[model samples]
Target: MSIRALVYGDVDLNTVDGSAVWAQSMTRCLAAAGCEVTLLLKTRVGNERLTAPLDGAPGVTLRRPYEESLLDDLGPRGLTPEQAVALITRLDSERRFDLVVLRGRRTAAVAAHTDALAGRLWTCVTDVPQTATGLTSAVVSELTDIAVASRLLLCPTEELRGFLESSVPAACGKSVLFPPVVVPPPEGAVGPGTPRTPLRIVYTGGFAPRWNTLEMTGLPAALGRRGVPAELHVIGDGIHRDPAEWAKRMGRALEDTPDLVRHGGRPHEEALRLAAQCDVGLSWRAPEADTDLELAAKVPEFGALGLPVVLNRTPMHEELLGPDYPLYAGEDLDSVADALVLATDPQTYRSAAQRCADASGRFTLERAVERLRGHLRLALPPAPGGVAPERPLKVVIAGHDLTFFTGLAEHLMALPGLEVRLDEWEALHTHDQYRSRELAAWADVVVCEWCGPNALFYARHKRAGQRLLVRLHRFELHTEWPRKLDIEKVDAIVCTSPYYADLTRERAGWPADRVAVLPNWVDVDQLDRPKLPGAQHTLGMIGIAPSRKRIDRGLDVLAELRRRDPRYTLAVKTKQPWDYWWVWNRPEEREYYERAYRRIQRSELLADGVVFDPYGPDVAVWLRRVGFVLSTSDDESFHLAPAECAASGGIPAVLAWPGADTIYSRRWIHEDTGAMADAIHSIVTEGRFDAVRAAARDEIAAKYSLRRVRGLWTDLIISGGFPEPVRPDGTVPAIR
Candidate 1:
C-alpha cells in the first residue's frame, strides 16, 4: 500500500522562500519514495510561473487558499495558521493520512495541540531560537509541546539538532537531520572563459538583513577595487521584511547598483540554470546573528548546479565544505572580493567545482529520497496491520448489555498505557451506525463484548490495522449473529470458558487457535467484606428472570436446606420477572416464573424463607447478606455469581450443569439439590464455615479475581498476544 502523506506549511510555493522550497522539495522527495502526497499551501494560488514544475508531478496534489475559500472570508489576511489546522483535520477525517509533514514555528505550534494530528506529525521547526538568550522558557515550552505531539522533529544540520536538544531537554533524541533535497539542474555549468577577468557571482533565494543580500550587491565594486572586474547577478524577487532596514537597503541597491543585475523571480529550473551560468554561487551572510544552526538551502542548490558556493565559515558550513577549502569568505567586501578573484582562476575554479560536486552528491534527490524513505520506514509501523510504538493502544469496547464486560473494560482503563472508550449499543441487534463507524476508525483494537450486531458491524466494515476481537457468550452461539459474522475479518474470538471457547470453535467453525478463554473475574479485595450476621443461614442467587437459569432448581435446594435447618433462607437478587420485556413477553417464560412464585407463595415454610432483592451495581454490599451462592442452570458459558460469591466470604453451591464442573471446583459442584443442601449444612453445622469461606475466597482470588485474569485480557487485546493476520504480501511490519 502506498503511504499517504499530507504536506502542510504556511509557505507560498509560488516563491523561492527557504521554507517554501523545502516544503515543495520534500513533497517531491516523498513522492519519489512511493508516498501519495497532497501539498496544502496556506498562501494564495497564482504563482504558476514559479510552481509549474510541481504541477505535473506524479502522485502529487497541490492545494491553495483561494480554491479552498480560505481567502474569501479573510480577505487581505488570508488563511490563519490555526485555520490551516482546521483544513488539515477536515482533510484527514475524509481520508486519514498516515503521516503529516509540517514546517514553520506557528504552524507546528498550533498543529501540535490538534488531537487529530498528534503523534502523526513530522514537524520541521527550523526557525527555532538560535541563541541561548533567544531560547527562553517560553520558546523551550513551545518546542517541547511540539516534540511531545510529533513523531519526529526534522533538522537540516547537527548544529540545529544539538542546539534544540541541548536547550530543550524534550528535543533530545527526538530529531532527525534532514538536509535539503536538491533537484540538480538539467543544463551543465558554464564556467569563466578566456582571461576570466569579470568573475560572475550569483545569489539566489530570499534577501534579508542576516542573509546579506545588500552586502552581496557591493561585491562587484569590491572586485573592481581588487583590479578584477566582476558581475553580481541577484535572482528571486521576494524578500522577508522581518527587519525592514534590510528590505529598504536591498530596494535602493536593486535600483541603483550598476554592476548588480536584478533578474526577476523565475521558475525553479530557469533560476537554477541562471545561477549555473555564473562562475560562483554567493551565499555569504552577515555575522550579526547566530544563524549557524542550519545549512543554507542555496548552497546545495548551487552544488546541484555544479558551481562552487561562497558561504560563511560556520561549523555547519565547514562540515559541508572541508575546513581547508579555499573560498571561505566573510560578509565584508574584501573577503568576498578575494573569493571572487580566486574563482576567476580556471585551475582553482575546477578544484572548487569538484569539491562542490562531491559535497552535492550527499544532498542529491536520490539520496534525500532514500534517507526520508528509511526514516519513515523505521519510524512508522507499516499500514494495513501495524501499530506505532510508545503511544497507548486506543481500545473501543463496543456492544450492547456490557454488564458482563464492564469490569474488564474498567481494568483496561485503569492501565496508564491504554485509552478506552465505550460504544454502547441500543440493543443486542441494533447500534448507532455512524458512531460505530467513527469508533471503529479511531480504535486500534475494537472489542465487541458479545458477538452480536456490534461484532457483525465491525467485522463487515473493519479497516486495515484495526483489530476486531469478538467475545462469544453462550447465548450468541445459539443466535444467528455468529452464523452471519465475517469471521475472517475478526482477529480473535474470546470466550470466558474453555468449554464455550471449544463450543464456539465447533459451532462457528473458527480456527481453534483463534479462540481464547478469559473468564469473568470478581474484585476479590472489594468483595471480601465482613459477612452480615446470620449470613451463614442464607442462600443466594442472582438474576432469575430467564427460566433456563433454573430458578425452580434453586427453590428445591433451598427447601432441602430448610428441611435440615429452619434458619436457612434463600435471597434471589435480580429484577422481578415482570420487569423484563424480553422475558415477560414470552408466554412460556411468564408461566414458568409465575408457577415458581406461586409455589413459593403457597408453601408456608418457603413463603417467608425466600426473599427477592432488587438488582443493582451494589452487588458487593448486597452479597454480604448471602452465604451459599447457588449456580443452578441448564447450561452456561460461565455463571459469574459463584465466583463473586466465593469472593464475598461464602462457599459456592454450584450444580453440575453441563460444563459447570470444569469451570468451578469439584468440591463446590453438586449433582442435585440434595447434595447442594447437604454441603451447605455440613459447613454450617461443623462450624467450619469461616474456614471454608477463607479457602473459597483464596481460591477465587487465585483463579478469578480481576487481578488474576486481567493480564490475559490485556495481553490478548492491548499487547496483541493473539494470532495476527499475515498480510497478503506475507510481511508483518515491525514497529520500531
Candidate 2:
C-alpha cells in the first residue's frame, strides 16, 4: 500500500519564498518516495516555476482554500488555531491521509486540537517569530501545546533543535533533523578554470543587518593592500533594510576600484550562476546578531558552486565545518580580508573548493527524501491486534561474494517481522551448493548478488509464485552473464545507479522497468571514528590490479602530489597484480600490469613514496591510517571503497569516470592528474584535512547508512509493488 500524507504551510505555492520552497521540497520528496501527498496552502500561488513540481507529478495534489492576503492573515483577521484544526480535520476525513505535516508556528498552534489524528501529526518550526510586543502568556501556551500534540517536531538545524527542546520539554525526545534542501548543481557544471588573475570574490543573499551587510564593501581594497589583486562582485541587494542606503554605502566604499560590479539583484538561479564563476564566497554576520541562527542557507549554496566560504566563526560554523577550518573570519574588516587573501592562493582555493563541494551533497533532495522516509517509518502505527506472523518472509540469498552481500542479509535479518535465510554458492571450480535446491524451493524470495551462474541458476529454476532478484554490479555488464541470465523468470534486476541501469537496458535489451537503482550498503556508523594525526599525509587506493581501475592514473596523481610536497605518499591496500591467475594467461592484461609496474619502479617519486599492503580483514582499521582515498577507475556501477573511506572520515578524490558524477559532487571529481595533485595539496597545506574528512563522513552517514539501505531493500523485496517490465515498443505494463 502506498503511504498517504498531507502538508500544511502558511504561504502561497506560487510565491518563491522560504515557506513555499520548503513545502514544495518536502512534498516532492514524499511523492518521489511513493507517497500520495496533498499540499495545503494558505493562499493561491500564481508563479509557474513555484507550481511546476505539482503539474506532472503522479500521486500529488495541491489546494488553496483561503482567498485572504498574507498580511491580513498574520493580523487579527486570520483564522485561529481551533478553526485551522477543524478545517484540516474535515479534509483528513475526505482524503483519508495517513499522516499530516504542519509547518510553521500557525500550523503548530492547530496541532493541539488534532488528537483524532494522534500518531499521524508532525510539526515543523521553521523559526520563532519575535513579536513586536515581546512574548506573552497566550503565545507561550500555544507554542507549548504544539510540542505536546505533535508526534514529531522537525528542526532544520541542531541549534534550532536545541532551542526548541529547551523551550518546551515535550519536544526534547522527538525532534529530528530537517535541514535546508538544495537542488544539486547540473551535471558537468564546473567552476571557472584555474590560473585566474585578480582573484574574483562574490557575496550573495539579502543585505540584512544581521548578515553584517555593510562590512563587506572594504574587502577588495583590504586585500589589495596585502599585494593581492582582487575584485568584489555583489550579487544581491538590501532586504529588511534600506536599499538606497546600501547602494550609497557600496558606491562610496568601492569607488577606488573601477572594475567593481554591483549587480543589485538577479533571480536566484542567475545569481547562483554568477557566484559560481567567482573564486570565493563572503558571509560575515555581526557577533551581536548571531543569537539564534543554527546555520546559514547561503553557505551550502556557495559550497555547491565549488567556492570556499569566508564567514565569521561561530559555534554553528565550528559544528558544521570543524573548529580547525582556516577560512573563518573575525568581526573586523581586516580579519575578513586576511582570510580572503589566504583562501585565494591557487592551492589554498583548490582544497577549500573540494571540501565545500563535498559538504554540499549532504543538503540535497535525495538526502531530504531519505530523512523523510525514516521519520515516516517511525511515525507509522503498529498493525491492529499486534499479532506475530505465523511464518517470516523466507529469503534465499545466493552470491559468490558473501563478503559483499553478508552485511545486507544480516541487516535484513535484524529487522523485526522478517525471518531471513541465506545461501552461499561456491566458485565455479569448487561447484558445491549446500542444499541449494531445497533452499530455492523453501524460499519466498531469492536474491542473487551478481549476474553470474547463481543468477542464471535461479532464473532457470525459480518456481511459480516465487520471486527472483538479481543485482548486476560493475564488470557483470561487460561479461556474458547478462546473456546467460534468463530475463523471463527474473522478477527484478537491481543496479547500483541509474547510469548502469541504462547501460544494462542498452547492452542486454532488458526491460527498463525491471531494473531499479539501489546503492550498495555501507556501515557508516562503524566507520565514524577519530583518525590518527599521521593519516593526513597518506593517500590510499584499494584495488589497482585491474586495468579498468586505472591504477596508472592513480600513480600519476601520486607523482604530481609528490612534486609539490615530499610528505605526501600513496598507500595501496591490494594484492600483487602478478598473483592474479588471469594476468599472464591473458596477454593484454599481462602487458598492462607489467608496463605500469615497471613505471612505478623506475620513477623516483613512486618508488620512494608508494607502499603496497595486501588485502586485510578490517577495512575500518585500514582506513584509519589513510587520510585521502583515490578512485581512478575508468568505470564503476558504484565504487564502495571511497564511500567506506569517506565514512571513516577520509577525503575521497574520484576521477570523472563515466557515471561518477551521479554518485559524487563534481568538486571531488578531478579531470586530470594536474587537477588532482592541486586538490591534494590544497587540502593538506591549508589544514582543512580534518574538515573535509568530517564532511565526507557526514555525507556517507546520511546517504548510505546500513539502516537506510536496508529499509530500501526491504521495501523493494517485500512491501512496495514491483513495476512491470517495459516492452520494446516503449510501452509499460501497470505495476504489480
Candidate 3:
C-alpha cells in the first residue's frame, strides 16, 4: 500500500502567510513523493481557492472541519482538540494512516496527546518555546513534554534544534530540522545587477512591533545625506494594527521624503513579482523582544528573486551567512544606512546578491522537501517486496516502554515477509481507544511488551485471525494484572526467565504449552571490551534505586570488601535516586531515601571508596572499569546488567533473587550480601576471577547474543508456533 500522510494545517491556504505557504508547499511535495496526502485544515479556504501549488498535485485530498465562513475572522486558528480527534478518527476509519504531520504548536499538542496518533505523530513546532523569562520557566516543562511525547519533534532551524536538544536530552534522537521552504522564482527571474532607478529598497511583511518596520522609513533619508538617492518599497501590511492607522503612519513618514511606497497586502505571487523589480530587501527587528529562532521567510524570498537582503545580525544569521557578511546591521539608523549603501554599490552589490542567491538554495522547494522526505523514509521504511504484499504479516509491538526492544525491532525490520510497527503508549491507562481499535484492525500479530493494561487491551480486542502474545518480566506478575489479563484470548505468553514463567503460569492458570521462555537480546559484540588495569579492584552496579534494587545491600558488601582490602572501590552508574518523580511526592519513599542518604554520609563509602556516576550512553566504556558486577536487587526477571558486565570481562557477583539462578550460575548467585563479598574476594585471591569472567562471557555470547538467536524471533513472528498446513491426504503441501 502507498504510504499516507495526513497534513494538518491551522490556517486558510488562500491567505498569504509563512505558515500557510509552508503547509501548502509541504503537502504538494509530499504528494510528489508518492505519498497520498489528505490535507485536514481548520480554515475557510474552499476547494476552489486551493491554488496552483496544491490543486493539481497528484494523490491529494482536501478536507475542512467547518463551513467556509466559521473561521474567516479568527486569524490562523487551528482545529480544537475534539475537532482534530474527530477528524483523525473519521479519516482513520477509512484507512489506517502511516504518518500524521502536525503543523503548529497547538496542533502538535492536540495530536501528540491524542492516543490514536501516538507513534505515528510527527510534530513541527513553528515557534520558539520561551516567554519573557526565557526557557527557565514552566514553559520548558511543557516543551519537554511535547518533545518526549512525539515520535519526531521538528523545528524550522538548526539553531532551534540545537537549543531544544541541549535543554531536553530526550529530544536527541527524535528531533529533526525542517528548514524554511522557499518557492523558487518564475522562469527568467532577474539576476544581480538588474537596473533599477533611485536604488529601490523593498520590505515585505507585517508592521508588527518586533518587525521594526518604522526603521525602514528612515533608510531613504539616511542614504540621502550620503549623496545616494533611495526609495523604499513596502509590500505588506500589519495584522494586529488597523490598516488605516498603519497607512496613516507610513503616509506621514513619506510626506517628509516621499520615497516610501506603501503597497498594502497583495497576493504572495504579486508581492514577490513587485519585489523582483526592487534593488534590495530590508528586514530589521527590535533586538530585545525578537525571537531569533525564526529565520524571516521574507529574507529568503528576496534571496530567491536575486535581491541582496539588508538584515540585522543574529546568531541564526551568522550561522546561515558568514560572520563577515557585509549586509548585516544593528538597530540604529546609521547601521541601516550603511547596509543599504553597500547594497547600492556596483561591485559590492553583485557579490552580495550572488551570495544571497546561493544561500537561498538551502530553502528551495526541492532542497527543503528532500530533507523532509529523507526523515520520512527513515521513519516509514518501505515494506518488503518494494511495497505492501497481499498477505504480509503485520506485526505490531504494543508496549509502554520498548527501549530494550530497540535492537529486536531493527532485526525485525530487516526480516523478510513482515511489516512491523511499534506502538508505544505514552501512558497505558491514558491510551486512546480509537488508536487501539485501529491497531487491532491492522495487525496479524500483536506482541504486548508488558502483562499490564497493554496485554489486557489486546486480550479484550483479540480478533479471529489475529494472534496475541504478552511478554511478562518480573514486576507485572506481582500486581493485580496477572489476575486481570484474560488468558483465554491470549495465544502465547513470553517470559524473560523460566522462574517467572512457571510462577506466572501457575498464578494465571495458563496451560504449560502456552508459555515460552525467551531471554532478552543484548548486543554482545557491542558490550565486549578490554577491562582497564585499575578495574580489578573496583565493583560496579547499574540501576540502584526504587528500594527493590537494594542499593543499601550493595553498600554493605562494599564496606565488608573494603575492610578486607583497602584497594577495593565501588562505582555506581545510575540515575540520581532522589530525582525519581515519586521521591518528593510520596512521604514514605522520601523517608527511605533520606535515611539512605544519611547512612551514606556517615559511612566511608561516600568519602573515598564509592564513585557515583550519572547515567550515560556508553555503557560498554563504563563497564571497562568494573572488575566485578553486583546485582544487589531484591528481585529481578533476568537483569541484563550482569550479563553486560560478563560481556565486558567483569565477573558477576549476583545476590540471589527469586530468578537469579535462571540467569546466572549457582556459583555466582550468593545467599547474602556478606557471602557475595566473600565470593568476589575468593575469586580474586584464588586467581579464578579471569577464568570465571571468560566463562561468563562465553555463556552470554552463546545464549543471549542478539545475532545468535534473532532467527527465533523471525520464526515466532512468521510461523506463530503453528503446525504446517498439509493436504487431507497427509502429504507435504506445495509451495505457492
- If scored against the real structure, what TM-score would every candidate get? 0.54, 0.48, 0.57
TM-score of 2: 0.48
Model 3 Cα lDDT, one tens digit per residue, 198-270: 8888888666556777666888889899878988888754454545677566556645546888876666667
**Quick one: RMSD of model 1?**
23.6
lDDT of 1 by residue, 29-76 (tens): 999999999988776765775457777699998877677674346555
Error of 3 at 613 (Å): 12
Q: Which lDDT values do the candidates have, in the order given?
A: 0.79, 0.72, 0.74
The better-scoring model by TM-score among 1 and 3 is 3
Clashes (N, CA, C under 3 Å) per candidate: 1, 1, 0
Best by lDDT: 1
lDDT of 2: 0.72
Error of model 1, residue 437, in angstroms: 27
Off by over 4 Å in 3: 12-14, 45-52, 64-96, 131-145, 168-170, 194-196, 242-257, 289-291, 385-401, 407-736
**Which whole-number lDDT from 0 to 100 does residue 202 have in model 2?**
81
Residue clash pairs of candidate 1: 384-465
